[model samples]
Target: MKSNIKYKKTKLSTTTKIALYKTMLKPRLIEEKMLILLRQGKISKWFSGIGQEAISVGVTMAMQAEEYILPMHRNLGVFTTREIPLYRLFSQWQGKANGFTKGRDRSFHFGTQEFNIVGMISHLGPQFGVADGIALASKLKNKNQVTAVFTGEGGTSEGDIHEALNVASVWQLPVLFCIENNGYGLSTPTKEQYNCENLADRALGYGMESHIIDGNNILEVYTKISEITESIRKKPRPVLIEFKTFRMRGHEEASGTKYVPQDLMDQWAEKDPIENYRLHLLTEGVLTEKEDAIFKAEIKAEIDTHLDKTNAEEVIVSTESNELNDVYKDFEYQNIEESSNTNELRLIDAIHEGLKQSMEKHDDLVIMGQDIAEYGGVFKITDGFVEAFGKDRVRNTPICESAIIETAMGLSIAGIKSIVELQFSDFVTSGFNPVVNYLAKSHYRWNQNADVVLRMPCGAGVAAGPFHSQTNEAWFTKTPGLKVVYPAFPKDAKGLLATAINDPNPVLFFEHKALYRSIRQEVPTDYFTIPFGKAATLKQGTDITIIAYGQAVHWALNTLEKHKDISADVIDLRSLQPLDTETIYASTKKTGRVIILQEDSLFGGIASDISALIMENCFESLDAPVKRVASLETPIPFINHLEDQYLARDKFEDELLALLAY
Candidate 1:
């Protein structure tokens, strides 16, 4: 239904109208050809944006070129509006060697920093969170830039969307949240999605300005967006603009229209943005019919030419040499190869030192977490950072875990290295999608290095219980393209964090909460880095090998001290991703016995992997079967007695003696 306000004539000049017509027509024709390609099996899939061209064109024209746009698969018009090279678009669709992702990704799952467009996956919610990061980065830099995020009405139901909106609102970031309410999300109609009569009204809850526009009306879309864009540039506040439009086609070329009514489709077709805008231009004397026809023909010819050229380009064949060519950036330790100074520091202070030192080294470093600013984190790991680095670098984010990690990913994409802190390690599950799907695979898929360090204060013994205490290193260790580092000592904590921040891949730095105050060491004043995949042999022995990490290392050390007669060599597997299996095997072969220890649950923990590695490599050298000691497979109890009983140190010691005797 049209708005009650009287329809006003567009004040756009003839040249502007002509330009809009040409811009809007480009994506419509491109998408039409894409569907044809899909039918011919030349392209794998087709997500048509047939009726949403005006929104894409209008928003693109309203925002500056430097402002980033995170477009979904259906927003093909965004690429066209941003003037991404026609051949590059066709090449990406054809999955050619010169594509944005070098043919590693097909469809709309690609982005380039050069064009300020973010790569989008099928999941729409997280992209908004990532876009919030881009906007936050721009605001922090004091740049008059804004980021535009495009999502469908159905995506607004996702928790990540709400989280992004809340974060954007609370921070007063400059973000344009453009929701294309295109009637249906895949197949579910708007009736099943939201209870609100107008989606824009939801913005009022966040205390942000809201507007609803007839997306098919190109002139109206352009004028409203231009006004909002100007206002956002000045105030840097998020604005939610729900463009009311409809999808005239099925969800994709493969999907049929059985879910949508023929009448509804017909109604939307009559309100086609391309055709309506062309008629408006004609009526406004922007172009003659002959001129309009020639312009469309020219666009069709251009698309066809690019399509043929992209089709002719060589397809990328996955080769042995290039298989892992760009999975990780090669980094070598340059300075401070060995420890030289003797300055005692608590684990917490060491961590703070590492962050301070890293920030001193890199100007683009940003630390974001809950209560990390003036409050200095729940554990005070980032205390005094806000004062030292300023609020712009040491940001206190809202308690949105998904947005936290996703924002770090976005900031990394925009060339800002980020250190994200999950107040407690247990909360990593809340942000699992971005960490596993986006952060972990970004380097492997697009050769983009997400330079993010996720500081997780993990482990038990402090009686913080299951909700607060968790050793989630195993989850990330199993995930490819992520570096998992768990340091057991203050020295290792400081060194590993410095190394993690420098590493090109995303690193999950697990800091034991119990060890924060319990462990004190004379850490090096000068910076030093311990290479990943290299295990440190803390003590030498001939009886057996005790391989452990995190708090388990301390437990094993105490076990050895209690039974001095049974000499044991302890190996610390600092980095879980590039595990030092060689060190583990050598120690196991020498001692002829292995005991793997971890603070995580026994069912599926890092200890299980360690035991498997010992058996696989040092099976013949073993004098007895490998023993594993881990927390019981149950949620940590809130009571200290139950938690202590769950982690029986005596039982672990008894198992160690049995292995030694065997």
Candidate 2:
């Protein structure tokens, strides 16, 4: 460990030095009390940062209040340095109503915009990508703010950390990546985790400036961080700082420290950051023993007051009415007049029109995806977007789905609405962690709306096979906060996209590859939006009802037109989540028979849920058993002949005839 042996009097003022001392001391005292609570069985878990106070406090003290800080669970000094209320911290651990998450999340897993601190998720690596996004937001808005994110040496091994560093470097965003290299990742030593000698060497791979320093030296940590932050403010850059420290305790209170060698723990105890810094101040005459005693006494009294107050508070009880509240933003739909003048547009062109319209309306809106900037996307959906919106608003991301999704969450949390396009819908599975765990639950957990629109080009009709083709609407529809929208025609595509971009919740917008260029319609030139959960009745009849979305909707229309005798009501459910149950029941009651169709597989598909809903709500009105037509339960084959056989379109005619006969 390299140490700055001498601390200059001019480098840090007396006030700032004392403030850093107090900042480091608060977390040490707070965690000491928390460990006592853990032993008494009052607290469930305790993650101590006893030996890492210098790194967390030093890095955080350099950041401005407007800049963001995403902290790991063990970085208690970060909260203390940022001046977060001690009572609120106590309330959060006790699950009281006054907590950051209103008793929704336990411990340090809550973020508040007021403080510019994003709470850590249990999965720590994803927050690295999120910090990049928050930095991106600050850059796009010309805020000139720097974001600081902390993780341990264990986190550097995660793919998300690599993706985030690559993105921040490529984009030249202002982000400080701090690695608390605590010598162990829950008993796994540094040698077992990486092949390199120093973890900071990994930053060179991403074209970032790297530094290695003695983390136990408080003055050294603060001096280096302040200098890095000052340089980053002038010219945005991504920097990596590796603090070679040691974890003096177990991973958590429940996880015993037996795996750690007793000799190593004894060695680190002699170099305790707080005690070392305290002795240095005393030796240098910067502080007297009496002043040190006063500072310690003040911190202890403050913690005791908040602890008592938080313990006396009542726990929050969730009611049925508010339990589902904030899952989706429910605002009154405003009906806009459609233009008499119209333009003939293909489905792809209509989607482009929606994007242009949205960007023109909202200055804070941004579009991010792989190959979207210069290449204009694989399908040309975002062609000329960079020229129109500039590269700042229109971004080209690396082929990292997880980082792309997690970055969008960070931007959304920072109050910037974003639209992200997955080149292929099948790749959504790669980005499923943030979408399901973070994005889907943001609103419910903390009333945090990641107003992000995810555009997925889906379905199998283009002969693209399994890797590029998939309709995964069923996956998001089951998620509470996600709104799933699948449009069939060009006009519907344009209108629904406009609505989705303006929505205050996460929306999964599915665009069928087959329909992109094949489908054309006369769409209104003026801006228009179709309300979610309202089914459009295409062709009405009393004999049978065909309910479908995306490419299946067109298949139903084609089948009905071919057989004029089989008069049927074709209902297009534009949005799957807000199911349009009223229109569905009305159409099924009039027709007395129904057939639900989908391009996805049969079992556990969206059609299954619709069938169950029909049975529960309108079972008595059905004259015959409801039928479902969907693709075979297997991966889509590459051969065109096999693909054609696997699709539901070929089988739709027979299923419709069977339903008519019934």
Candidate 3:
């Protein structure tokens, strides 16, 4: 199955032409229905899959049911053909109840394993990672299912796409990557998008089998996709297919495409994929005008009925409310005797115990970081796990932060919930590219969770010095997709870590080394997982309030002893992402005076965010202006003495002075 723009130069049977024509007409009718729905004020927002239907319909229809389809935003054609009820599409477009994924999902962003559509991610090629993952899962399960991921020319630029490709090719994973080149990326033409004329050729770097095809021609597309998908399934290798076509419609419904050249639109519109395929079928003597008209009308009525059913649905439900339910199956937990009734299990011990338990329960749980395995991690948090779990489960990697995230992402794509450590929160800057561009936004961009866990020790107290310690939760506090957690107590350390491991979203677990072993408290040896967004209160008072997290929780606790008569309340923020302002407000409303303490530098830290939260939520409850105690904004000195002097060594004492003076 191969093709060239000049001509396919291959013979096709009349029956084959009829099947291709029918497949092409079905998607065209669907597109027409969606367009009509848009003008009727029923459909609001959507990215229409207008011109690339030939490839989408042909490849997906030719794919075996056991194999998987990981499509992109432009793959509604493929999904519609897979029997995803048109009502499901209409419900999703209108955010109505019949949508199946529930109203929580967006258009062209739904998937179902029952339909053999393993995953559909809209943020371009994030499906590459997911596609690789399903393939990995298939191999691990010894199943014969192959994974096919589709992306556009622009997606080839993302690191995640290449990363997935590299790993898939290296492992000879049963996967196919289809690149639909529509000649433009939001008006940025292919020349500006990449140096290569044909993006599939770039797959050579990863030893991937590559092909170039005429995407608008249904016959050519069907043969190529069938051939490539079959070859990968037989030999278990990765392949790349570049479909050359033009995007006749704008990037999306709301997109004006003002930047698209009128000349290109005129030329490409003349070669509309549906029309091209119709002519191809006719030239091959497949269907008469009467039969073609009847086929078009029949599909149009079917889509019209689907639209009626979808619009009649309530605006509340999704295609499947059970999406998050039982995504993991038969999880394995550590088989160990319960701890004896004893006070010896500290918070750090509890965290270790929890991770040990989780890894024992789920084979998909993986751990990796610098010195994590060989050295049991820089802080010894993961000590002795390498011997117990084996290197494949508890592994170590090189010092490259980008590579660490990339590999962990691949591991996540491989169906493992990887707990990747960055050693320190301050050093996360090295991996910021992947974290911000990929990990943090992967779920939001892909319209599905990636579930990669990033673990790092944070905070500046305990005199570890600047390079070794820092707290920068606010750096990503506002990022929408990533969950950041900075637990303050031993109990939270254990419970939060446990909860984080089970969450479907990527969690930035900032473990303060200063408190990892220093803070000791009773923790349940049992699986008493604490919720991720809740806050904890350590003490209650009336005159003033002190807010803190991580090492600052210790300082707040110690200050409580001296300020007992001052009527001060303290708050320990267990999770930074969903900051428990309700708890913070309850305490501040009682104390009236608010003060935030943080171990990070004064320039920009969680304290600033806390102050803003307090001012916004508890402004009128204040008897005085809110105050903060933070380390000075400077590099941490290597000397212990200099480091001590550099941070808020006597911050509590100074805070007390200011409170009493006020």
Candidate 4:
């Protein structure tokens, strides 16, 4: 490691120096106590930060109290330095109800907004983008707050880290990207991870300043970080700092360090952060042998007292308690009366109007996606949005799907409402982790509000091939804490989108590409919001029931119009997650037969779930088995003839006739 010790010129007060020493020593002592508990089989796992006290304590102490820090699994010093209660921290490890996550999550996989600490998920890279978002919120609100996000040498390889770095640099966000190069990512060493000599060197490619620090030297780590953060707060720009350190313990207690060479361990052992800092303080006359012994003893006693209190706390036992009730916040839809004045508009125009009105209503609302600023996006839905809302609100992003989605989560964390438009619905797969894992589970895990609207332009009939067109509502509907909205007509599109933007939970809003200009209706000119989980009965009948959403709703309506003789109930399900089962069951019982339609493939689609729901609830009322009319089980073909054959539209009439005859 390079010796970048530039701490000679920086003078620290005696009081500050002693405080730093005490803060750094606390987690190391806590780790030792936790190891004893692990051996006693009282705790399940532990990620020891035995050798990494300097980076966590130094960086966190350097940051302002109002600023946020996103810490990794091993940075227990961050929690301690931030003055988090020891009893609560121990309770989290013990899975007690008093923990940060209320025992919904384990270890440091939870965040406490009260302490301005955002904890990392198991997938470490997403937090970088989330940090950028929090910084973006600060920038927008004109606050001099810098967000510090940490990752390891192994985590730098993730695409999200690179994307977040580029975004921070491009947007001039105030973010401190800290990398702890601790030699190994699990069992893989730095040599096998990346060919770059130093992870800080990668910052040059992002046009950001980079620095290397001797992470074992507490004074050096503190001085450099304090200087860097002061510069960031003044000018509001991101900087990358690579802290060259070593993990003295196994990645976890269960994962032994047998793979690490013996000589390498001995070399790192000689430079233990806490031991070196204590000796340096003693040599500088800031600490004496008696004082050091007293401090160590006091810390051990504090840990024991907290551990005893934590042991007395009750462990979470009820699986069916408040855990189920906390998955999503109750969203009561406001009934905004529609105006008598109306305009004949296409589905796309209705969505645009709704978004424009929403921006007018909420000053903190921001919409981000690729080509959304100047180009108006691929479909021109946001053509005039940038000019109206300004660049800050109507932002354009790179082709980093994961980063943008995770960034939206950060914005929500900072009390800003956001909308993320995926250029195509098919690209959702690239950003699935933040959407499904982080965003969906955040509220249930820690009561974090994710007020984000993910607008996905989906469905086929435009022949854009498989990559550009898809009906993937079923993907998000299966994930709890997400609302799925797929409106069929112009009025429904406008109203449902308005509702989605105002919702407190994450919402997946699917706009059908084929219905953009094809479907037109006289929509209310005034702002209005349609309630979710309420199916609109377009046509009322008693003979049969046709349940559908998105483009399939149009297919059902067209089929019913063509066959006037067949009386059927055509239900347009505007929202899928909070499904209107009352309307569905009423129609199913009124008519003994049902046809569920969807543009997605037949196998494992939303149509299958609805079919099963009807069978289980209204089994005796069924004249024939609940029928599902879906696309063929294959990738949507590019050729017009093959595409037509792959769609469910062609088979709708035949399936309707067969079901009617039953």
Candidate 5:
């Protein structure tokens, strides 16, 4: 069924058509280059935009540079409108350093702030949230720059899409969400995806003004986008534009696509943008066949040169070294390497002090989440924060984690470094989709890291069983871009929290309620930040090494005292992502055995990661196979005896003994 997109034809001049088609040469050339690279065994697979170039050029030409754009994998064409050079783009596809994103991400995931392009991410529905955020930030900054997000029609059903639209509508952000209905999300057609008559009407549920347009026509796309963008600029409100286009090629050009009907393909192919636009331009006398041939030859020559340059460039090098350097341009960690002079403050006091110092030091900092304003938050982590920073800065949000994270992403894009409290780590799952798909992948995708800090309480000992007692680090341990820092001591807590707020990437600052007021280490007299991924050896020994993080660090500290004969080294793997294989190996080589400790389920925990790394790098140095100590597979029960029987210091000691005995 054809969409009632309210399309009107305009007689574009020959010069206008020629100029637009010439501008599209780069993306079309890129599509052709994908075929050359694929045959040479350079690129494994690709998604060609051979027939979909006009929609991107039209939308891009309609927007200003300062306006935010969240692109999909298929919108690599949109990226050319950004400043990503063709050689660098080919290098990315060939997996090289000079590539657009420094090779931290795949070909489809490169963008830069130089283009006002918020990164291109691949989490089916989460880009909508980021688009909403850019819009929110525009409103907050009082800037006229609207945010444009490009996605597929298949992404409409995901909860994140609705969450983002609803938030954007409620906040009335200046965002134009463009859904490119390319008919197939991999194999499934639009017919199989949703039951709605038109995707735009779905926006009405969120109170957003939505319209559909002929995506294949450059004039139609540009005209409607211009009108909607103007509306966003004039009134600064959210609008949705559903582009009714067709995917001429398969997703990634690898699978024997069992989806997308042959008849639909043939029909859409008949309306192919590249071919149709060529005919239209020829009919309007935009160019003679001679001129068209020359233009095509020029595009091919340019693409060939780019491919040659890419293969000569460095390929698949680690950007891990580049991680720390490019992330923070001006934000510096407050270095405090002095002796501890302050008394051990309670966990609550420590949290308050750390946050106060952070917000004071950085004016860009903002705090938001449920009950985090004048109410001082559920755990009172934000006590007296609003009085210090005002309600606008220290925000209290509705009981919605997804909305809170989406808003934080928006604020971060607008120059606010947000510290969002998740109330309890258990509730983080509500926002977990964005964390892994958006927050974690944003930097790798766009090359511009949108920095947001998350502070949440996590652990299993405070009787908040099942729902609240989960050790949530495992959820994001394997995620690429995010940094998870778990501080065990009062000293480490303040330092790590300060550092987390300062870092440019999303940092999960996990705090323990059990240690909030009970256990205390000598904290610093003043504010300071401990660098991320730096492991600290609590106690040194020769028989076995115990690797622990967060609350388990204290447990390991206690277990070491109980087993002096064992003489084990206690190493804290504080930062999770850049797992310190160096420290783990050094300790393992000396001790001859390794044991990873955690308060969560041992079946799938951080301990498994430690085991894998040691086996990969320091396998020959081991005296025995590395063992793991963690909670049982079942959820934390309300009964103290049942919980204690499964997880704690004794369980850790038993695991260590088992490894030693082995």
Candidate 6:
């Protein structure tokens, strides 16, 4: 697991050596102070990087300040080396308002955009893909910026690591995959984590050069990372560098090192990075004992001063009204001028046109998905996108949903608008973590805009079977930070999609595959935007109210047209997350009878939420109980008859009649 190839000593100037030493020493002292605070019950938790400061300081010092770094929780030295204000970082630890995440998140689980550092989510692997996106943006902008992302050896086993490596290699992005092989991932040792002798050996599988460095040696780590980053900046390719090190502390303060053998711990103790580096500095006469003592005293004093200030600051206090603030950015509806010219387009074509128009308007816009470039996607929504926008803008990704979703999030972070088309909405589950955890929560957590649109081709009726057919809007609607748009008509699809793309928050734009070619309408040729949280009433009637979205909207309209006796208000809720409550309540109170329809299974769909809302707000105006007509509670069937029997359409008319008669 050790590198046999010796590295020639790279001479450092006296000032640079002192700076590096100070950077490494600052985190050690700060963490020591934090541990004291944690033990004193002042702070909630701490993940100590007690003996692993070399990797964080060395790699951060080697990379340019303009380059991005996605640091793990243990990379406290990265923040210190980047010169982020110690007071702010202390406030973050204490969950104060001035922290990077504004007390929305605690500890190092927050990112500071001004410092060009992205903090990792609880799930460790997604930051790799986000780093790739930052590198991709650098390449597109010709900035020659290299992105460095850190992880442990155990994180190498994540699918995201593999996907990001392959993607960076294929795209020839300038990235440094910094793996601090810190002996163990929590209690799991490297012997049980992987079969490979060294984590760097896996780099060959990714078609990228690899390096193994003595992480305990600060000089070697700095030299190796500097050389690797320089080479990558010039050649623009990802390289894996495994910094062989050990975690001297538990994974977190609560976790103890009961599983680690005493002999191994004792062996690593002698190779303590800071102690060994200090000895090296003294022996070389670069730092005297008096100077080292002065540095330590200065760092300790600075940390104590900032700790007092951070503790004195008011802790985050949340109220019901203010708690909901910034879950989504305030959106102002723009009235776009439309030309008289119109085209009769299918739902898919309208979406295509909307994307083309958006891409034409926004130079930073890029579309990414599997087979979306030349294959035009499974539903052909992005058919000619590659030809219209170039391969760079129209990207085809490997079958790595989580990576691509988080990659799009990265692109958004770097001021690029991205549209990720999930081949099928059902596949969103594969990318669910990033969509819900990272992208959806980015804005609310750190005030970072994830200007990405996920085009989900959803719904059943085409008999594509269980995997491809699903109406999973209910999955994301409950997630607060995302905007969900499911348009029922071509005009609505085009307009709503345009609006979603322009929105600052992450938006899930669901397109029903069954309605792709079936629905047609006179959509405007010119660009326009339909405001979110607004429902479109297809038909206005006084007897009963029918609320639906996607294909079910068409079913409601068709059933109303077929039965002339049925007088109903057909409400198409184009946007699900920002439910059109005003329109729904008005219709419900007008008719006093309501039926909510959904193509998803009946048990836990959006219909259930809408029914509950009606009861809670419009209870006094109700004539009868709200009816929820939805698909049968089972996976979508492939057979024609079974599929029809499972869909809500088969029972929609009967349900409508019952609600009307109520």
> What lDDT would each prediction earn against the true structure?
0.85, 0.87, 0.72, 0.91, 0.77, 0.89
Worst 10 residues of 1 by lDDT: 1-10
Residue 368 lDDT in candidate 2:
95
**Model 5 misplacement above 4 A:** 1-18, 24-26, 29-43, 101-105, 255-263, 274-301, 304-334, 337-344, 396-416, 433-447, 474-481, 520-525, 531-597, 603-629, 649-662
**TM-score result, candidate 2:** 0.97
Tell me the TM-score of each prediction against the true structure. Answer: 0.95, 0.97, 0.79, 0.98, 0.81, 0.98
* 5 against 6, candidate with superior lDDT: 6
Give the top-scoring candidate (TM-score). Answer: 4
Q: Write the per-residue lDDT of candidate 4 for residues 1-662, one digit (tens) a residue.
A: 32222235458899999988999999999999999999999988999888999999999999988899999988999999999989999999998977888877888899988999999899998999999999999999999889999999999999899999999999999999999999999889999999989999988899999999988888888888999999888899999999999999899989999999999999999888878777777767789989999999999999989899999987677667566788987677798978989999999999999999999999889999999998999989999988898999999998998999999999999999999999999999999999999899999888897899999999899988978877888888899889899999999999999999999999999999999999999999999989899999999998999999989998888888889998889999888988999999999999999999999998889899999999999999998889999998888887789899999998999999998887
Q: Which parts of model 4 are misplaced by more than 4 Å? A: 1-9, 319-321
- Please report the candidate that would top lDDT against the real structure: 4
**lDDT value for candidate 6?**
0.89
lDDT of 6 at 126: 95
Clashes of 3: 20
Report clash pairs, candidate 4: none
Tens-place lDDT digits, model 3, residues 192-250: 99997578879878777888988887777888777777766667888888988888777
Q: Per the 3 Å backbone cut-off, how many clashing residue pairs does candidate 1 have?
A: 0
How would you encode candidate 6's per-residue C-alpha lDDT over 145-262 as one tens digit per residue? Answer: 8999999988988988888898988888898999999999999999899998998998888889899988877888888799888888888889899998899999998998988999
**Where in model 1 is the C-alpha error above 4 Å?**
1-7, 337-339
In model 5, what is the error at residue 360, expressed in angstroms? 1.6
- Whichever of 1 and 5 has more TM-score, that candidate is 1
